[model samples]
Target chain A: MLSKSAARAFFLSGTLLFGAVFIWLTVDTFQRIPAQTNAGDLNESVVRGKHIWEENNCMGCHTLLGEGAYYAPELTRVYDRRGPAFIAAMLKDPEAVYPGQRRMVKYDFNEEQISDMIAFFEWIGRMDLNGFPPEPTIGMAAAAIAIPGGERPQVFTQICTACHSLGGVGGTIGPALDGVGDRFDRGYLMRWITDPQAVKPGTQMPKLELTEEQRNEVVIFLSKQREAGL
Target chain B: MKYQSQKVAYWFFATCMLLLSLQLIMAFAHSGFDVLHPWIPFNVARASHNNLLVMWLLAGFMGAAYFIIPDECERPLYWPRLAYVQLIALVVVGVTAIIGFHFGWWEGRKFLEIPRPLDYLVVVDVLLFVANIGMTIWKAPKMTTTSIVLFFGLLMAALLYLPGMIPTDHQTHDAFWRWWVVHLWVEGVWELIMGAILAYLLIRLTGVDREIVEKWLYVIVGFTFLSGILGTGHHYYFIGTPSYWLWIGGIFSALEPLAFLGMAIYGVALAKKGGRNHPNRMALFWTVGCCIMSFVGAGLLGFAHTLPQVNLFTHGTLVTAMHGHMAFWGAYAMLVLAIMTYALPLLTGRKLFDTPSASYAFWSTNIGMVCMTVAFGVAGVAQVYLERRAGMEFLDVQRELKVHFIGLILAASLFTSGIIAFIYNFIRYGLPVGEVEESVSAGAAAAAPAE
Candidate 1:
């Protein structure tokens, strides 16, 4: 067996050297992030939001800074994709936003708490993470869709693409609209877009409730869509 | 059993098995695959699963120490009844923590999820265990290299738990200290415990000289400390820690495998050099199997993502789950089973090592775990590519990977079957009885080949 002294010497030096390196690393870690960027400010909204995040145990499903469960999407860049308003809307009524998912157990948070959650996500969005959770490809194509009126793309961007994909560039909650013009006539488009549940009961799509003029305008725009290269 | 107090170790091992079964059950609930309690939900189930795992392994370590220390010191236990009190306290704290997780009364930290109040309770329980083991060695007429090393490992583990309790509000700061408990325990002091246990087993099973086996133990300890301590940097990288850790963590953690490699070499060399004469060949299989498999799991698989470049993609993914299952199974779980395999025969005066079920338990568990690792590997790789690389939404990737859990569930069932068989054999042995026979002790001395 190793003599008692030799064993002790080995243990001591190894531990000392290792501890020295660890301390150096810890010091470097503390100094790495600038004061403004790290999660230390504890501003009223940020502090409250942090508590809400912990109290609700949001990390149980959603990952923040890639440290939580992988069952939900990485929320490190959530503020960028879904803006604060959309996040607020989703938090207010999650079942209305997207349905039939066991993940993201929605709790009843009031307006202030929702605002705090938004502030927390906004803060995380600002952290200097080195190119984590690579940016999404959808809606990032730079070329805005051609439209007959300015209101058409605005309506599509604001409401429609939350559930529908167009030209293979949106959420997958609803069907893609690349060939909608060929598939449906103006009358059919008007009926479907204005009151979806009237035509297909149990459809997740809620009524758009557009004016008659606006309905006709949306129909014209949607009916004009052909296959991308056709 | 050699000492009357050694019977206490049986109840502790039984607790380990019961808790392990609970962990498995909670794993299903966490995945929402449970029909019984679909409402158990992810947060509570995840906490229970992870916490139960740590608790059971702690129980196993305590049992292993109780069984080995008296024999190595060549004396009866220092305080026999005190061990029972410690075990009961450990279980009470564990159950309360599990119940607390359900009510959302936990500190939300991964691994160290028990709230601050329970954290204090856990500390008290550990102190009791440490003091009991400490006094045992103090009062022993003789102390072997094995007992002293085990004592140091336990004591250091108790000291290290304090760092996790360091209060911090900063997320980065909290994560930094949390790892001081998690990483240091698994890769640092636990290796010492494993080394000491392996040393004790080799000395007894291999009929090798205690001197020869323990000299190798020194080398293993040197390797573990040299690499494991600095290797904490690996977790520091990209958790809002220093950019410098990318280099430091990568370099040091890469060297961590050498320690496991040394253990594998030490185990195989001792087994080969010592004549193939131990009657309980199953124990030898588990001992050598633990060494080799830990090299693959903790050494090779851990090295797979230790580098910052790879960890950026693979951290917190199922790839981690892959490494975790194999490494914990190979290193700690098999080490416990190895001791039980060796001790069970002596503890209960039954030699079931040569039975068909005994060999089946060893092969089936190892094979089942390997298959489970492969399934996790495939899912993790696909997740990294789709979610991280292609920038697919998180829930989308999970949907695609749902099919992979089918493979995981099937493999886990096979793994559970093996564990059941092992536990059945343990039960059939029908508890500790009788004294250590004279002939066995005489044979142990006479068969010391190197001496």
Candidate 2:
């Protein structure tokens, strides 16, 4: 049988050790919080949006800060993928944007409430997470739109590269143009590039304004992309 | 039922059973009915389910202490009327909090969902309980290890609840204090309570010496405090805490299984040494079964994800659900059931241990819970692979796991049946009566110090 004094000593020492470690860890947690959280996270709009999120139990469907329900997408980096306008619109009417799937229920958020939600998303985007969701570093340069140390490219980086990819480089908001020559000749390419809305009334790509020389240069560049199939 | 005042325990346990059934109903609403989405949201249902669980378990522990304390102290309860008042207040607070959850009057913290105003009521309720138990022990002729340990555990549990109430807007800071209540209660102080109850059961069931059993209790308490207090670090690994927590959490939580191993060994060894002397064999079965299953569920399964490397993949997944269901069932659920099984016949003066339903309840509940744990494990691993590992969409992964939930529902059905049987048996035994004349001699014989 164990001695009474031995058991008492063990209990006392164990309690002390446990208390010491817990205090140490708790202090460390407090020290790291201010650095990791974003400055604008505590702003009025962001704070109001946080209350709205909690009141609606959004975390029941979506994950925030790696916690809560996993039924919906992680809302951590949503501000980067779709801008504030898109987020606000989606909150107003989810089915209009995300058709064919009935996942996110439509919340009747007014304009100001929608803006607050966007503000919350924007604030969360700025936290110092040390890269929790690793971003894609490759294929991010504007080389396809305007190649460095050469003649001025026909393609405008602000217009074409913002939505489309060319020669395996650029954005993916629109279709890739790696083999556009196979799909269209120079004549069709010129008309399509000049007035995209006339070709497809509701297409997302905007028509680019170009001079005669710029138009010809863009067509010539597009014609050379057929080498992939050859 | 050595003391007439101990009958107050019956009401507390009855409330436990009532709350448990409600918790199960809410679980069904969550898993089975997709149509109830708008009216009863998932968060409302989940918060109610978890809060009810905490309420009932707290009720169970309170009941067990009331029953065990009077006998261990060799005295009647200090204030019998106070016990009844405390029980009514506890039930009132619990019902109000649960009802408030549906209307969104909740703190939104996991497990500690009761709103700020109701939290004060809970504090008052617990203080009344602690004082009642304290007075009972103080008036006793002599103090025993079993009584002192139980009192300390209950006091610590009350103290730990305060950390969850700390006001904070920072998410990381909130999570830090929340784990102090959650982790410390389960892994730290509750183990002391479980150990004391286990020792009491073993001493009574085995006809073992009090000194030997209490000695084993000391070892279990030591092991629990050594590992479990530091084991709170495991929760800090991913909650935006300092990087040093990863090392501290991983190391300490890895050692947590040792305490559970000690409890399991203590139970099994005591049973083997004592042989089958007690007529209530089902109580012994539940006592020993609780220890072994606790070791497997809380000890081994918890260790699986306690390491930082594994937790990164499995942190908030259904893997946690798997471990949670089993650990709570094996440790606290079975501990309460053991006490009930031991006390029921004595309280009502009915010897109904040899019934077929009693045997079925033991086998079916244990087997069904094990199957449910496996189902959750399979679904969780699949979810981790599809979503976290393969970078699939969250909704798509949830759709894939819908099939596994079918298995969970089936296993839960079986588990529910066993619980029904146990409750039916409890009802048939009727209300608590005064102690039988023969039990007075038997109680003395059991309490006598061994040579």
Candidate 3:
């Protein structure tokens, strides 16, 4: 049985320890993001967009910076990958983003608000995260498919094999694109190869420069791996 | 018919508890070993532990209540024949459930997963028990003794079970009610059963005033029920629920276990004040130990996690396991053992079998549990340090501390060993309960050599 005094001391120490940790974590969460709203710098377009944002309470549907309800998509880094003009057109008529697909209702906002919405998205894209999630590197294979009698394999093993591998010895930190050519035709592959995430929305996969020759060689090499597997 | 079968029903129940224990041991030990899997295999040890314990406790309660209830009501058995049927159904379900849990066939609900079909068997069995008790109590009105505590308990057991069986599509609501089944019953309702039995047993064995013990029992039940319902608040602290649950959980949960702690201290104090000369020494050991343990383990250690802040660290850790081991053992295990100590000798016509073994078994179980509590606490504290301070990955911490957790397994082994010894001694002396036979002079000469 614990003496009353001993029990009291135990509780006191526990309370102290708990309070200290609680305060530290709470303060840390608070300090992680600055709370100062950038409302002061808003132009006519941005102000109009802000009104739209408030009227609809966009957070009710979408997540912004891991806050708000998770009913809809995250819009934080969407602007960097998309065009400003495309974004404005989507706001004016959202069905343009993906034809015949459900999207945000086209609120009656002027062209200025649509531009401000683009500005807001651009601002969201600029906020830096210190490499918490490492950047994904893809689609810029130094090798390409040969039209016939090609040596694409040698080129691929030298460059593309570094970040991605199939079934064995190589760095496996990236997605295995060993047979991706089989999944798409040449036109689809070209669009995806140009800037990877534009074709696949919200993909962390980045795009880099690849000569037309190298891209075809890599596509041909990936196609060969699938044929051999089958 | 029922009168004749009640004793037999108890025998069947004892067999079931022992068998379930074996099954649990098999699953746990097989998983422990490096090679071949046990009779039932998979990642269902958690389910096995909980389900087997629940079944065994139910069986023990059935057996204990059978003996004590009739005596309290001052009547013959009410449909004793039904008891045997209940036992058979219960054993079938218990065995099947244990096997299912052993084989990785369980959905991972903490307190309420027994696979859908087999759970029906348990419900039927408990329903029978409640009907039997209720009928018996009604026929023999004003039969409020220590036995009557179980009437409310067995009823709640069924009532609490209903929410768990409902399969809701919304996972959040499903999880919410899961806590209602696990936390609310353990915290609120089962204590009535425990209180009734403990007070009755205490009064019976201590030769203490019945009024005093009953008074305490009433208070204990009152405290337990009142605090227990809100005790579910603690679990709501995290669980991906809205933030409003914070205040609802924090205040009420803090109050939940304090009553148990008070009961523990008071029970121990009462035992001390009563002094010695207990008839069933083993029964006394279980009763007293349970009183103390139910408080410290279920009450105090649980309090550490009821807070949202601490639960994030200790939620899935060995700390949770530690409290579970002690609280279940103290609240349910000890209480059942106390009842067994009484009923075993009554059926078998043995007295001194329990007396000599009490001290040794008491020491063994207590040492093992205390060691487990310490080991888990240390491990939990260490885990907290690694996660909160070192900023190590969760998997990394688990990998680093894999060896230290061996202490808990070791403590558990020790506790099992004690039960083995206690059971052996009990069987040797506890069986064949009746008046001792006197020997003739000629046979006495031969008996001297055997001695």
Which parts of model 1 have CA positions greater than 4 angstroms off? A1-8, A34-36, A89-93, A135-164, A169-171, A179-201, A206-230, B32-38, B434-450
Candidate lDDT values, in order: 0.79, 0.79, 0.59
- Comparing 1 and 3 by TM-score, which wins? 1
Docking class of 2: incorrect
C-alpha RMSD for every candidate:
3.9, 6.5, 16.3
lDDT of 3 at B140: 82
- DockQ of candidate 3 (2 decimals): 0.03
lDDT of 3 by residue, A1-230 (tens): 44434433543454345435533533442343332223234346544554455345454334333222222334554464334644665567654333322234456778666777787666555544222111212212212222222344544554444335543323343566656656766677667756777899865444544567777776666655553444
Which ten-residue region of model 3 chain A has the weakest summed lDDT?
Answer: A130-139
TM-score, structure 1 vs. true: 0.89
Worst 10 residues of 3 chain B by lDDT: B442-451
Model 2 residue B446 lDDT score: 62
For candidate 3, what TM-score does chain B get against the true chain B? 0.88
Error of 2 at A97 (Å): 5.6
Model 3, position A22: C-alpha lDDT score? 38
